[model samples]
Target: MIRLVKVSKSYGDTIAVRQLSLVVNQGEVCVLIGPSGCGKTTTLRMVNRLIEPTAGRIFINGKEISRVKPEQLRRSIGYAIQSVGLFPHMTVADNIAVVPELLHWAKSRVAHRIDELLRLVGLDPLEYASKYPNQLSGGEAQRIGVARALAANPPILLMDEPFGAVDPLTREKLQAQFLRIQQELKKTVLLVTHDLDEAIRLADRIAIMASGRLVQHATPEEILSRPTNKFVHDFVGTDRALKRLSRIGVASFIRPTHSVKLSTPMKEVASVCERCHWVWVVDDDGKFTGWLDRTSLPAANSVRQAMVVGDRDEITITKNATLREALSRMLGQGFNSIPVVDEEGRLIGEVSLGDVEAATAKMEP
Candidate 1:
């Protein structure tokens, strides 16, 4: 939905961006990544005329941006940045309602959009709507910034290090939320980041820029497995194979495994054998609860009495989770396999370290 042809931005003698040409297709995220002075952010700003390009044509869905009014062009495109840029004086709902209200949407419609966008970003409208930006934590502000950008339901989104300001744990969560939101909303995105992990995790295509010019533009898989040049190779690093594993989902490797309901008699749990010395334990509704260590029989009636319970987030992974995450969890917990769950935490299957190993073996260069 965004097309830049030979785009160049210069300030006096120094050119911030030089003849950079790229295309971010409809409904896919295109990440612009490179080193500190590589002009990835400059490239993003040029898309919405935040920093006008000195040379080259910029287009949003085939209409040249230079031909459109700056305010109109920007309003039609969503913009998010590292600092979050939330207005401290404005309440969360009012902040999100900015663009929609600017468009003259009905007051009632604007209010509904506020709640809807807040929820979409995983925030409660009731608790957060009346809050000011100063009341929000860094992560909350980042989420609010995203909600505001998406407030108008723009087809194109420009994000400049959207998750860069947060801590690692919070960054991971924000990335996951962004992925889920993108899956549902399907907005075309052009994001700028220096993080290779973030690029691999989110980009459908990675446009690696250097010295204000496009160095390589390709799918993350191809970029990792086959670098176009020495610069691209070094930029991707020696752990290219490992990085590729992050792109594979846990669902692809899930295997059917034995499981028992929490209500099952301990005697029955002790008899059923998966040969792993443990059986997955779930509730009556089939939601994953814990595990039954068949190796140690307990003097109890039901599986719930004998089984070891675990934190849902800590012990189980969702179908969409990357194998890299699963592998990390397994190594951290010293387990060979991890349970895979659905959105409702229902046990689907398990993915083993062997599965992760087999996948990584092929990626070795």
Candidate 2:
């Protein structure tokens, strides 16, 4: 939905971006990533006219953006940054209400929008509404920044290092939340970051920049497996094979399997998984409880007694989890196979280390 055609920006003798051209498809995230000085942020800023391009044109949906007033353009396109840039003096509600209020939305409509946005970003509206920016945690503040950005329900979002300032754990949570939100909102997004892992995790397409020029722009799998040049290859790092796993969902590799019920006879459970190393055990409700080691099955009377509950929570991957996450869980917990569960924690399928092995092996150089 957004297109940049031969866009370039210069500062005196230096060029921030040079004849860069890219298209961010409708309802897809396009991440711009590179080294520190590679103009990823400059490209992002130019989209919202925060930094006017020295040359070339930007178009949104079919019309050129230059025709629109900067304030109007910004209001129509959501913008969030690394610094959060929230007004410290304003209450969280007032801060989120900034854009809607600017647009002269009705008082009732603005109030509803404020609460809706806060909830959408995982904050308690009633509790957080009166809290000022200074009163919030880093993660909470960033979420508020996002709520403020989405106050107007814009179809396009421009983010420049939006998750960079938060700690790694918080950053991961934010990224996952953004992915869920994106699935629901389907906004055309252009995000800038220096972290390749973040790009791999979040991007539908990646634009790699080098020394103020567009080096390569493609899907993460293509960029990882078929780098256009040495720079692109090196920039993506040596762990490209494992990185490709991040783009694949666990569902794609899940093998349909049976789970023994808690009331099932131990002998029956052993027979059911006679050829397997372990069998997943579920409760009467079919909710996953744990797994049973076949080797321990003969001496056990019930599924509960012999069930190997070795950090099952830590080793479990949701059906929607990336294969990389499954692999990481396995490696971290020394698991041969990890059970896949639905959102309700019911066993759906399982992914093995061999599953990831086979996937990467098929794509091997």
Candidate 3:
């Protein structure tokens, strides 16, 4: 929904952005990232007219943004920054109500918007509404800044290092929460950050910038697997392979197999294991119970009585877990295979070493 065509920005003798061109599709999250002073932020600011481009055209939806009044254009787009910049004198509720009030919304509507935004960002409105910015933590204030920007339900969002000021743990939480919110809201987003990890985690498409120019624009997986040049490869770093795994899920590699019930006789367990080295055991309810080792079956009565069940001693990958998680668990525990389970701990399938190896090979350059 946003497009920049041959956009460039200069401040006296220095060029902040070169003739950059890019398009952020409707509801896509596009991240701009690179080294310091590479014009990523400048490109982001140009979209919202925070830093007017000296040359080239910009568009939001279909109309040229340069043709619209600055104030009108900005109000239609949400903006957030590293500093958060919440008004200390205003209550959290009032701070979030800023944009709505500016747009001449009724007091009741503003109040309702404030409450809805707070809840949307995972904050308790009743508890946080009356508090001033000074009374909140850095993370809380940052959340308020986002809520304020989104108060008008703008279809486009411009963010510049929005999570940079928070601690690492808080930053991760915020990124995850923002991703969840984005999935639900689907606003066309243009975010600027120098952190590659952040770009990989949050962006649908990453635009790598260098020396005031757009170097490459591709999906996170594409960029990681097939960087266009030495500059792009070095910028993405050597850990790109590991990062790619974090984008795929365990379900992509899971293999279906036969499962044994805990109530099954030891002889039956051994018979089931005749073709395989091991058998996964489940309870009467089909919840993952444990596994039956071929060597231990002949010495016991039932699968439940003979099963080796001390925490199962088996690594498990949740369906929602990334392939990186599965790989890490397998490598860390030195296991040949790992179980794949659902959220409720029911076994669904198994992931083998071969599965991980094949997936990694497919993603390699």
Model 1 global lDDT (CA atoms, 0 to 1): 0.90
User: Which model, 1 or 2, shows the larger lDDT?
Assistant: 1
For residue 316, model 1's alpha carbon misses the true position, in angstroms, by: 0.8
TM-scores of the models, in the order given: 0.93, 0.89, 0.77
Q: What is the per-residue lDDT of model 2 for residues 225-309, given as tens digits with 9 covering 90 to 100?
A: 8999999988888998899988888887899876898899877887888778778888787777877878887788888888875
Error in Å for residue 254 of model 3 = 6.4
State candidate 1's TM-score: 0.93
TM-score, ranked from best to worst: 1, 2, 3
Candidate 2: list runs displaced more than 4 Å.
Answer: 124-127, 167-169, 258-275, 295-305, 310-313
Off by over 4 Å in 1: 298-306, 362-364
Off by over 4 Å in 3: 251-319, 325-355
101-190: candidate 1 lDDT, tens digit per residue: 889999999999999998999999999999999999999999999999999999999999999988987888899999999999899999
Worst 10 residues of 3 by lDDT: 308-317
Overall lDDT per candidate, in order of appearance: 0.90, 0.88, 0.85
